[model samples]
Target: MTRCRLCGSAALVSVVDLGATPPCESFLAADQLDEPEPAYPLHLRVCTDCWLAQIPPLITPEETFTQYAYFSSYSTSWVEHARTFVADAVQRVGLGPDAFVVEVASNDGYLLKHVVDRGIRCLGIEPSVNVGAAARDAGVPTLTAFLDPATGSDVRAEHGPADLVVANNVYAHIPDVVGFTRGLRALVADDGWVSIEVQHLLTLIEENQYDTIYHEHFQYYTVASATRALAAGGLALVDVELLPTHGGSIRLWARPAEAAGEPSRGVADVLAREKAAGLQELSGYTEFSARVAKVRRDLLRFLIEVAERGETVVGYGAPGKGNTLLNHCGIRPDLLPYTVDRNPYKHGRFTPGTRIPILPPEQIAADRPDYVLVLPWNLRAELVEQLSFVHDWGGRLVFPIPELSIVEVAS
Candidate 1:
């Protein structure tokens, strides 16, 4: 971690230290509760040299993604987003029946199913065996492997170069940013497009979205740094699009250097915005730790105040970001009591470090808790709709990121 993972520079500076917490997605089963759980430092640092914000690769992808719990199809909005992206991408690239599409980190075939529906040849390169199986079961051709240079080359050799490679919300997951980019280069045809969606560092900082930091996510990219990372693997960033998903994200349009032309004006505008926000300089990072500390303090104060009033606050989702917030603020089952999720896989499990019990989503309605702390707050609009029934009993929804917001859902 001393040298920058992207540029091999020794000019790393601390952005925020969230202390140590268990890997965010490692939910505990009832039988494994008593056993010792491993934890790793959840600190984020920025490279002055490359401006690549990253954490130490304390936990490897194999430890996290091989048997992953997250399934993309669970989110209604996300699935629609994927569907629309597929439709737009096909039209944007003039993709036809002869074109082949590939999605890296394609979870549960949430996206590729759309391509399949179009009668286009598509494959998913997913690392997790269980999720990959689910993809195959849904009629999507999927390769069960993590994306590295060798794996990318293997997929290219076997299936021929992809006409369109879609990597959404996974650009930050890998430790070797450069190698992953090379893998992306290998999978895509020389003139083919590679679309990557990553949480924008500018948005993460401006919006105070620190809970997204975890071992599974090694790097946070601004368009400036992302451009450099893409170039490291022989891909040139040619365009950029600002997205509303994941709080805020940037969709980078890249291609092999030979075909990559001048970057879009959108890229330049975003770069300017990042610069205006002081992302390139050390000043922007200076107060993030303090802001993060304030968020923790504000949340703990609210949770404690509610506890003292003998009011109950159950959680709405057992998301990884919620675990980070819980562990960082030292919240336990006493404060949260229990959380509920729509995902069946997490039904009987517990949050990693905080050990908050997870129950079926029905439990919230059954218990009629006073306030439901909405984890996965990025889905604020959707969850608010889903939890609108809470209004029947005068229950309010609580969101803990950006700021603590307590909103009443309509009946």
Candidate 2:
């Protein structure tokens, strides 16, 4: 993009360009395989003035999220993560029976269900009608709409201001960073807390998580840049927590400027780490593109070698990040055959650009594949446990990110 989406500066710097790919989650049905699928340039740029790493808004959330393919409840570990977060948040934020919690982008009520169990009134504001319907079916009150400034104010007006606003893994999804942040402010009480979890730019660069860069994720954030973005909406960041979910992420604790005091030591500590990594400038990012290229090269070489041996390599998850890797590496079904996923929405569908068939997880065990590439490598521990049955057939699991590694599983 010519100017920063957040800062309106023209000093955007290149990070890594993964050429072009279709919208990550746009799985095509078997009938549409013969039709043409569109692709867009997937380039990430960091605004020099604001230091916010972003991709041009080539695709909007409405295109991808309206009939979303992903359901958070499908992941056993992620559900537990949400349960733990709810329990911890109740204690940390002092949420009680009378308290009100609101979750933006609440998928299938995975997290808010915990709030309901505790008798704390909560509402989920979600854009996808299907998933939002699922949330309501689970007895979690939900509004089917995207979170913007006006929607937030209307929610506040109707349901009253929230005591704790939880927006996990969604801060990067919106192109209008300022408007989204302001929506967050409008949903929360003047003294209420706003908790946001996003993939930290620090870990994304350091860990070689380039696949996380897709059209839907408008920007990446370091603590320093996120703090500036929060200020635009009059929300003051007060504390920060490093999280292990989604490769690596940061949970930002914020409040209205009137109530927010000095930021916690963790904020300064993270900013220091970001600065030390040279993210504030262009030096830390210079080697990323080359490293990303290495990942693509190494993975292709391994897949090719496996194919030459007549060994089968199938994918384990149809995650969006997996599509980025699949498209970037130019891997087709020949290199890696049909993949499997626990999400039923992807079943019988094909991945966007690569056109690999998506099957049920049971297909892997049924076929007894030699190796199953775990696309959602961030869930290594949990997936290893779930796929341990692969050991019964002498099958191994492959993780393609942060370098390619094959692991043996024991039953």
Candidate 3:
């Protein structure tokens, strides 16, 4: 009996099976082309007791994040997002030179750069060796290790309790959610706040974002589910905000249980809305499998039709989400000639399961195709604007999920 990672619930139901797939970000070098890739069953299950959505257990953080290649600084939009977040957080939290800010999973110090510029003391806890080294190179003091209860205590001992702890897009990736939250409680100051950003599970189901399911993402969280989980670890949700980044996400502000602050209206409203929408009910997830099946069929049909017409089609963003979507749809180089990535580590490599080569964004300009499939559809607007130059050839952009749509760029 596989127990739910969040609430220790044994009543779990298998929702959707994405078949065997390689790790989403495990791009292969050209020389390592013949090396056999290990694939695992990409099965999704929902905890009937707590309503937590998760993938079947397989990989650990040590197996996944060590020697990771992803760098947050690669994306111009992400960098801008971090800058804006730091500015807003400083204003809201009244952080100053005396306050110490800690960031968990601070990839390449993309967000902490803004914090450090203000003369405020900051520390970053990152597990990936390559990305952690990059953060250190950027002059951000980062500890290259996972944030657990023991590490958190060590950080508090060395730097004192943190006044602010920022965890952006790391909440969903943690396998031991409760342990991580406990670690946050131990590291944060009495009046400190911890802000976490995660892809909202409600939005994932409603928006047909099944592509985000990968082994690395252990849980898909809702505000209600998250509140319950946090409360169990002596944390309370103080504020919540819906963010447009990462398809649809929620930024949760939490503090120690002793902090006497009223919960934000957004938190209550979202919880009520989720309850009204039956997110807390078991039937909500029971119906999701059929919706996912339709998406797979529609995406495959569109791609097949485009190929049948002899039209060239390529993908954008060699992200983990893209790998899951492509592999689930059984897309290969024969269908998608190649993919473009901004990250240098992935640029010359091939996507794990599909074996589609990843090249620089310049490839899209040099070899103009009839259609560009935007894989990271959540960043469609940003990507479309960035690749608007594709319009010179009268090419159209295609988005697979939430239905297929082709739009001509305004040149």
Candidate 4:
């Protein structure tokens, strides 16, 4: 058995094996579709010691993130999520024009643009060349480097200690998660806080969001696991908030251990809740694989039945999780003819393994397919509102995860 990335223990328990899939964000061009594509194993294991669910890093961050097709600004809902956070963080930290804000993995300046608008100094560390260029164009000072201990030290020296460090949805992307957290501690001022947002492991299991598993996301965190990682870096979690974004996520506020005061009651409440759910033990991780298998079976059966009836199907949103679900289920253009994404970078390309043609959102109105499978179920509400016109043509919406079902559009 492979050792746990967090605690380095040999007791990594099986959670689920999604088989092999191409890098979830590696969308392909038409010319490249016929060529051989590499697929890596999508197996998940939970560390019995730390209770952190994780997958082996089959691919490096350079291979997975540097040339990503995803642009956060494309998702209006996600950008709004960033805006709300920036507003709250500014107030909570009492940030002003003189204060500096640094965001690790700040994609396309989607969040930092707001910080700059308020005249606050901000720096973004983005590894992706294309997305970083876009962020620079948007007037957010961006550095094109992955943030590890050394790079974090350099950034801290160059930009000064940050009053607020934002690592939204990025904690899972690092294989050296401890080093990444160390970087956060190294960069933030002694009394400053770091905000980390990650998809909650409890929601992943209970909601059957198995699609969130891929090579890019090396580790999944429970509150306990996250606390351990932060504590190892001499950071203390001061507060926690459950967010509706990313299926269900936890936004943890942490401070340097030396300066951290008594943590809010929310911390103890969340930890106790996780313990009640058995996350502190191995038994909670068991039976997840069986539940995942059932989802795969039920989904395949639904798609097969629909295809047999000659019903037309197309997909909405080409998020990374969509690629994982599509590749794992072995669904191709035959099952899903084409998928539409608002992000232009993905348009005119094909999904990595499944090779479903990616189109513009207007394709939905032009084709008016019988069913529009909403692949990114986490943003179901936003997608439903955006694609309301589907109801005009008697088209229905399908959400594949947590259970595949047709969404009943409001009249």
> Best-fitting candidate, measured by lDDT?
1
Off by over 4 Å in 1: none
Off by over 4 Å in 4: none
lDDT of each: 0.94, 0.93, 0.89, 0.90
- After TM-score superposition, what is the CA distance of residue 324 in candidate 1 from its true location, in Å? 0.7
lDDT of 3 by residue, 204-306 (tens): 8888889899988988899988987788778999999999888889999999999937898888899997887788877677777888888788888888898
Per-residue lDDT tens digits of candidate 2, residues 1-411? Answer: 699988899998888989999999999998999998899999998988989999999888889889899899999989999999999998998988899999999989999999999999999999999999999999999999999999999999999999999999899999888999999999999989999999999999999999998878889999999999999999999999999999999999999999999999989898899999999889989999999999999999999999999898899999999999999999898887899999888999999999999999999878999998999999999999999999998999999889889999989
- In model 4, the Cα lDDT at residue 329 comes to 86
How do the residues 1-411 of candidate 1 rate in per-residue lDDT, one tens digit apiece? 689999899999999999999999999998989999999999899999889999999999999999998999999999999999999999899899999999999999999999999999999999999999999999999999999999999999989999999999899999888889999999999899999999999989999999999888999999999999999999999999999998999999999999998888888899999999999999989999999999999999999999999999999888888888999999998898999988999989999988899999999889999999998999999999999999999999999889989998998
| TM-score for each of the candidates | 0.99, 0.99, 0.97, 0.98
Q: Rank the candidates by TM-score, best first.
A: 1, 2, 4, 3
Q: Rank the candidates by lDDT, best first.
A: 1, 2, 4, 3
**Over the full model, what C-alpha lDDT does candidate 2 score relative to the true structure?**
0.93
> What's the residue-level lDDT of 119 in candidate 3?
93
Off by over 4 Å in 2: none
**Model 2 deviation from native, Cα RMSD in Å:** 0.8
Clashing residue pairs in candidate 2 are: none
Error of 3 at 97 (Å): 1.4
